[model samples]
Target chain A: MSAGTDTRSVTRQVRPGESPAGPAAGPGKTPFSARLRRDWPLLVMAAPMLLLVTAFWWIPALGNVIAFQDYNPFTGGILGSPIIGFTNFAELFGDPQFLRAVVNTLGITAFQLVFYFPVPIALALLLNSVVSGKLRAFIQGVVYLPHFFSWVLVVAIFQQMFGGAGLIAQILRDHGYSGIDWMTNSDTFILLVTAETVWKDAGWGTIVFLAALSTIDQNLYEAAAVDGARRWRRMWHITLPGLRPVIVLLLILRLGDALNVGFEQFMLQRSAVGSKVSEVFDTFVYWSGLRTGDFGYGAAAGLFKGLVGLVLILVANKVAHALGERGVYSRS
Target chain B: MSRKKVSGLAPWEEPGSVAGRIGKGGVLALIVLAVLLPLYTIVLTSLSPAETVNRVGGLVLVPDGITFDAYRQIFSDSVVSRAVLVSTGVTLVGTAISLGVSVLGAYALSRPGTLFHRPMLFCVLLMFVFFPGLIPTYLMVTSLGLKDSYWSLILPSAVSAFNVVVLRAFFMNIPHELLDSARIDGAGEFRILWRIVLPLSKAVTAVIGLFYAVGYWNAWFNAMLYIDDTRKWPLALVLRSYVVDSNPLPTATVGVNGFGHVAPPTLAIKMAIVSIAVLPALLIYPFVQRHFTKGVIIGAIKG
Candidate 1:
């Protein structure tokens, strides 16, 4: 009886997603081909969708194969191109701008992770503590507005506020003080970009933390209060501990994405400041390929960046698992 | 989970300290004021007359005098106006396409243990971590002859992996029993998705759809990268040229409006352009406000 059951289960394992594969199904049941036959309409339903994704997403993904070739938009397609065999990679590594780009990308990511990461947590705590729901809602609306604005508009707003002919400069000139060049200043460009990111996104980031905070059983707070814990103590012990898992999860995710480091923001600013401090991987791709028309080299450089980011995410997710947090990719 | 059972000490409890309450109110007021001030300045500048704008040294905290000339010029049948229309069309079409693709894709992936499900899920997840970068993407678009085409804008961003993940999580949250019963009744995957999942998941669908719409609306980066035709240019890119680069008149030559009116100053035109770019999103936002909060919160947590 045991041997017969094992054969049935093995067949089910081999042909997954069928009725016979169901754990509850009896061993005496015929195969799930009949069930699948009835579900052909279901297969038909998924066909167009499968085709769409396969063509647009999967096919183009294969186009990344040009990273190894001497790709030319005018002359050769991804396949027809001559394989340069890591020559593009070699040229990329030797380029001074490439090195600068890597450093700049990492540097910006580090600064933002330090400065911008905790802001939403703090904002959520403040919002949670606020007594007036109306006031809190209004503030939430106001703060979230910036996140919806495009990077172009955000950068424009920054320029209007701080650019050479902007209001701040005019105010300073009226006071006989020198207009500070925040936009084009290479030294302060990183800070300016980071600040802009925070202004645009900090409020939006609060949504998850706020959601998690709201789920913190109110009774937990009450229980702490009953223990004579003051508001701050309750926040420190009950609230902070409740937010712990979320914080860890978000931190892991952020680390995984640490290499991204705000592509559009950097790209928009690159032209104004020149490429000294502004050169990052994305910009490098644009300048090298689109601007200079070196498609193969640019493809190789981009591929390199993607590979590094993938490694980071995988490692970070693995670390999260080891630490016993629910990482992004669960084993199940 | 009962709301009535969850009642607790009210926030307006007898003030633990009089000074503390006063301080809290003061701080709140200050924050409100600070946030409003920059937005006020932008609105005032946009509304102020050109003469007043100049007189105020572009620091018009309050409008010296109000005029809609800036708004008028933007809305008039100029290059700016055409760009606005182009942007509107692209955003609407792109958002619809993206949401449709993402909804179908997310539904399929959310089904655990379906044939080809895990591999496809892994593929989507890989796209998130390893962005194939700009050059390869650009090459692909160019090679496909999509450069300068509207598809350049719509196709590249049609299925954002982040949106897929969020929608999948939402699909996952739908009780398994409903799906089981539907399957037993011989409802096809798409039938079950449309009849059962889609109806129940409207909040998330609306929210994710809005996000795609907003992204498409706000997308100037792709335009900057791929689009070369000035006639096909979107409002945001046009705004960039006017506001960021301080470029003159943007191909209207003052004649595109048909009255042959002379172009305004670089600043006035720039402010006008900025207002044009921001106005639509602002208008459309209120309609989606109800779904916005819950949708965004769920999306973020899932992400």
Candidate 2:
């Protein structure tokens, strides 16, 4: 994603009169002061953004140093704190609660990958197949509505419809059947969360896939039809192949984000199902770091998760490159 | 149902066998029902009379009578009313600041050969891979003494890197010849950006602005983390605490004059809060829905 955007702009920068050597090479050709004079307006425009990013993004990044320190709010600041090396990490790996959180995180991620990932692809195909524009638009709007809702709202809606005293339970009681405890059931917590996620995002997620489907050459489908390809066969061959690159790109991105199985969703429902089931890395970090005031320990767990995410993204990008696709970033 | 001829149906697309048509129709119906049923229930329950809501014991599927008591009660409450104001203020201010920063930065970064452009773009893109984890971010906010301030919410998320990249992509796609001609005609970069680029990029800018607004509106976590003062909380956070946390509505002491007679059911109140939280998005969504696909697709395909 990053590399693709950069390369486009880089190519665009190559003017007719300019040297073939790009902007990076231009620094050597022209004097620094001369270039600065010419680029001052753009620099001035970007200054606020640069300052904001430096404060929010870069400074917090530097604050990751606390992960390696015995961080205390009262006495030692981030850098002033005594270095603790990987002791916090060692403690994190040793803690049963942390292990449980890890297991839960992976479990949710895996479930989402298996069950939730293909849903949007399937939904997009279904929407794509609809010949009626009005029906398609209506369905699209309805589905996308849930995506705009906050997780708290989504969970509340689920509870309203499925909780012990919820609509479904009330209906079942009217028919002399007992109400089910699906909403607060720890055993089914993972499945419930996954279902909620699908309900919320599956339709919205189809936007990109649908866009990809639209870009497929219509002539290929017509030619396939002339060659006697059935609807199912055409979809399997022509349509699926056309969507493969996007599917791969999305898959890599999903894998990179596999560990972040949402904080708010789990946090909101944690009391209902208990932390034993609902606790994930994000909530775990929150509980240990902020809520419990174990900043160093929580920072360590968070840092560990961040590092894993970075490595996963890099590895995913490398795999994408091996598959002859541009990953998130290019080497250039 | 009458079968209307479908436009944009490819020549290769079959009319489909009877079974296939029925199957597709059934699946589509199921998908639509899955989405609409919960929304219907929420709205119905919110509007249902207290007696009907009590009888239902949860969400009212069918309304015996309509009552705006729940809405009146919630709106009249000091806490909720204050929360609404906070949310509105945060969303408007945050969106404006975000749009301003994003527009200026995107324009600067869009021109590739500008000094520090490559490095700035690289810095922005790095956000895609590495996140400064939650603890440090919280520490930073606290250390900066923005722990209880609204600026904490606005500042932390002031500039979305994805939006910036997407906006830059849109800027880059603006015909260079037009910009060049304007430049030759003595129009400065700012003038060209404001007068020409922004005017032409209305669709994209509007969509990105909507995205920022929605994000700010739906945001509760930042407020929950930073703003320890309950009165300063936004609607989403209030909604979460009141509805999801199942806290009883802090009875309105001041504005309960007319609402005192009609004691709405708990379910009705919960649904009403949910509706209030969602109402703004639903109101503006139709107007902006068309741009959703265009905006997201551009970002996905290019960025």
- Give the top-scoring candidate (DockQ): 2
Worst 10 residues of 1 chain A by lDDT: A1-10
Q: How big is the positional error of residue B174 in model 1, measured in Å on the Cα after superposition?
A: 2.3
Q: Write the per-residue lDDT of candidate 1 for residues B1-303, one digit (tens) a residue.
A: 122212333542223365665666676566566455666777777777667777777747866777776667766546778888888899889988888878878776665545545576666665555666677666667767988999898888777766776677667667778888887887767788899999998888887887888889899888988889888999888877878877777443343344454443446657767766777767876777667656745443433
Q: Tens-digit lDDT track for model 2 on A1-332? A: 22222222222222212322112345567788988876788899999999999988899888888888999888877757899999999999999999999999988888888898899899999998887777789889888888888888899889987889887888899999999978889999988999899988888888777877887888888999999999889999989987787677667666767787888899899999999999999999999999999899999999899999889877866665555234222311
Q: Ten consecutive residues with minimal summed lDDT in candidate 2 chain B? A: B252-261
Top lDDT: which candidate number? 2
TM-score of chain B of 2: 0.93
Would candidate 2 be rated incorrect, acceptable, medium or high by CAPRI criteria? Answer: medium
Give the lDDT of residue A203 in candidate 1.
71
